[model samples]
Target: MAEKITIFAHVRNICKASIFRICPPCLAALSRILARFHSNTQRQLVLFLNTAHFLTIGVSLALVVAFFLYAVDGRPIKGEDSFASEESEEFLPNVREIVGEIRPGDSLSSSFRSNGVDEEVRESVISAFDGVMNFREMKPNDRYTLTLDNDGTLIKCLYESGPLEVHAIERTPEGSLAAKKLDVALDCRTVKLRGRIESSLFAALAAFKEDAKLVYTFADIFASKIDFNTETRFGDTFELVVEKYYKNNEFVGYGKILVARYNSKEVGPLEGFYFDQGGKSAYFDHRGYELGESFIRSPVPMARVSSGFSYNRRHPVLDIVRPHLGVDLAAPMGTPIMATSDGRVRFAGWKGGYGKQIILDHGGGYQTYYGHLSRFAN
Candidate 1:
């Protein structure tokens, strides 16, 4: 019995050693299979949730698009249908404005015809301006404005001939046009202009932005005392109290020189004040002396004395030394020569050496001779 027990115990010990060695690899294989199964299961669960969430978002976007299209197609835009329904609505008379300057060789009739005015309307307009304006004297560059209806019916016409004058024509109630000349009501503002003679009176005034017309008027105001042509010195200064006209805050023109003061280096300080007395306007000095002399020193305004009165002088064309009795005033060839003083024409023909001359005899012993004239005044 002892030997049998020994053999059984030895077999049992051998079987226990084999089980311990094999159990290690079998347990490791089982753990790897369980880990792989858990990884695949988690991956499938994440994919399913992501696909379901995308499907839900895509369905919501499609529904929102469908709702937008359905809402826009349900109603029509406002004001689109009202335009055709109100076809017979009376609007304010459609006014068309035409503004332009008169071109060269343009007549009033031609201007009206070219601007789509009817024949009868043109004739009516011409008749309207018959006593008001001289249609024949319409000059180029004259600005005009015509107001008309949409059907080319004339409403109002305005012709601005000068800065201060306007000719207006309006359609009357009797279907005829009536014309009237309107002097633009000017707001006279007293302005003082001071300048020193640099080169010329015109240049000095022009530097001050004075109008050319104002310059001529200023020279005329002081014509008796100051010779604007050759007597203006470099340091000569002048102050003018002038009446400048304005319309709608825009300078229109000049009215008159109220007072003028001129200080010359050649001549002394001369002053003139305009005054209205005895139903006539005249300029007077500070001492109330009348500046208007019976005879103007120069026959032509702003003309220079080319040759003064002398016993011996050389002729320009003749090239001969002779006696020059009268002052030779230099002017343009076709310049209009006015009588220096109120006198009768003594001789109005060509003289010996003078080309074309006019001899005016005053009632007194003074006789004025105007030589090198183009023609005699009527």
Candidate 2:
């Protein structure tokens, strides 16, 4: 009953809600129309709508739809229910709005239950927004609003997660809930994050509470030129410009890192800028060279390189001089192994001296070989 206009849930919220009275004779005729309109509906509360029409382009006639009735909130004539003798609430419709932020570790079902939303209504809302969004995927502080009638009939449900995940459910003409994914109007602003590396990049960004993914991405921009572990000095600093998304003045999340710069005392300063070349997206150095080197420096961090790549090397088990093609990294016995980059597994199993090995083909004729006593993902 919030937006009792020609459209369901939307247009009337923008326009002002005004009340005007109709004559007794006109109301009697209007009640008959309402009776026919709600023959199948069983709700005792009756709500009447008001619609206004405007002129179209290139039309001279000024036509106005005048019903002299803003909106009605009265008991239905044929319904077997009752209303209080006091008619003070008869003019205004009863609409209760529930708005809340989804806190961390809080389920939508639990939040709904806490907010006086019925269990049946919660189930129906979840069913309506199933494919549109899984409630489990909604991030902390994501918002939702529910509009219900006096008797707790759901009029509208709005769930907002991000720029692409705005969803709504509204009561249709037939009184069934219909769900739809809405296009969001987003504001993208360039943001800056700067930090001095006292130790690792992760430690530097810990104060800002930035995600590890962003740290990995920021380091990848300088992966080819600078080996962060070996080259980073005590006073090295970094800064970057990133895009942050917002909806209706509320922040959503981070977007692309547009520009990044790393200032090192040893390696000097280097800058990388994001660019869209042709249809592909990649980062470019300040002098217009593509910084497309995406190789992970070391599969195991803080692990010493026991053996470096060499043309001729001693075979440890065989006691002979041969070509050692791969660099061997040594860490603790239970140290977890991680893939250097994304790839499809070409082989996984025992491979002679390689033993319990997994070979990943990273396209472009580049393949990484992981060997020795360790388990790998399928």
Candidate 3:
């Protein structure tokens, strides 16, 4: 009875909505029939709405899931992935070969042959290097390195001659070559050294661990007039400007002595000048006089001033006191002595008490003689 009553109430609510309106008896009978149909239509409408909403939500969720999986699997969309991959491939470097350093004294042909480089390639690289570096001037033990690209074009060529000078050659975009000069910037240094007369000039300057080559060069420049060993006073001072090479903030090596001033105790201020004149480089004095004179004084390079000029000196072999005419440069028996002045070979034979001697008559009464020579110079 309760179920029948609830169904009748639901039918009254559905039919009252103007779907049916008629007389009392007829309306009452039709109302029961229409109520039954209206109740059945309500149930079907509720089921259809729930099924349609479920299908819409399920299809939306599946589309979202499929998009996530496709992104993760790296599928190409609009072919963007393939185009990106091809772009990366274009930038990859194509290495042709690896070559080692070309040491000095290595012929171009031999060096390239060892590195598996062809003759034509070697000739091209050599031609490029010649424009910047003089290959003939290369010394033994100098360093050189080479590299190539995919098209057999030289990529990089590095050459190191000294601590300061380096040559770098690289290819340009126009398929030509370019050169860069990388000279280690020189560090200027001014130092003052003073000492008493010692065993040798090098020994006196030993307090400063200077470049021996530079010191020797300095001595040679002033060897003609100033005698560092004999003529140097006890309080003589030397001021010099030495060029040093510093790499990565550490001292590596030295260049030429750019400027040097030696105030000799006896002689006045002696200065050395290095200048480039008419595209040629040379050393000279402030007066433009070339530092290279006609002749260097001492034949033997600064071993020592063994003996000085004297009127009476006992001979070692003769064991008798005699007037030594010229300065006795006591060196090893085999040491070659040079001619102090440039003159014709007026005398190059044996003389009394002067064994195997050479006498160069420099005109006037001033003639230089080198005695006890192992071999006469040509």
lDDT of every model, 2 decimals = 0.75, 0.74, 0.67
- Order candidates by TM-score, high to low: 1, 3, 2
* TM-score for predicted model 2 compared with the true structure: 0.51
Between which residue pairs do clashes occur in model 2?
none
Determine which window of 10 residues in candidate 1 has minimal summed lDDT: 13-22
Q: Which TM-score value belongs to model 1?
A: 0.66
Model 1 scores what on Cα lDDT? 0.75
TM-score per candidate, in order? 0.66, 0.51, 0.53
- Candidate 2's displacement at residue 295, Å, is 2.1
By lDDT rank, best first, the candidates go 1, 2, 3
Q: Which runs in model 3 stand beyond 4 Å of their true positions? A: 1-79, 96-99, 102-105, 178-197, 233-237, 252-301, 305-378
Best by TM-score: 1
Native-to-model Cα distance after best TM-score fit, residue 120 in candidate 2, in Å: 4.6
For candidate 2, the clash count comes to 0
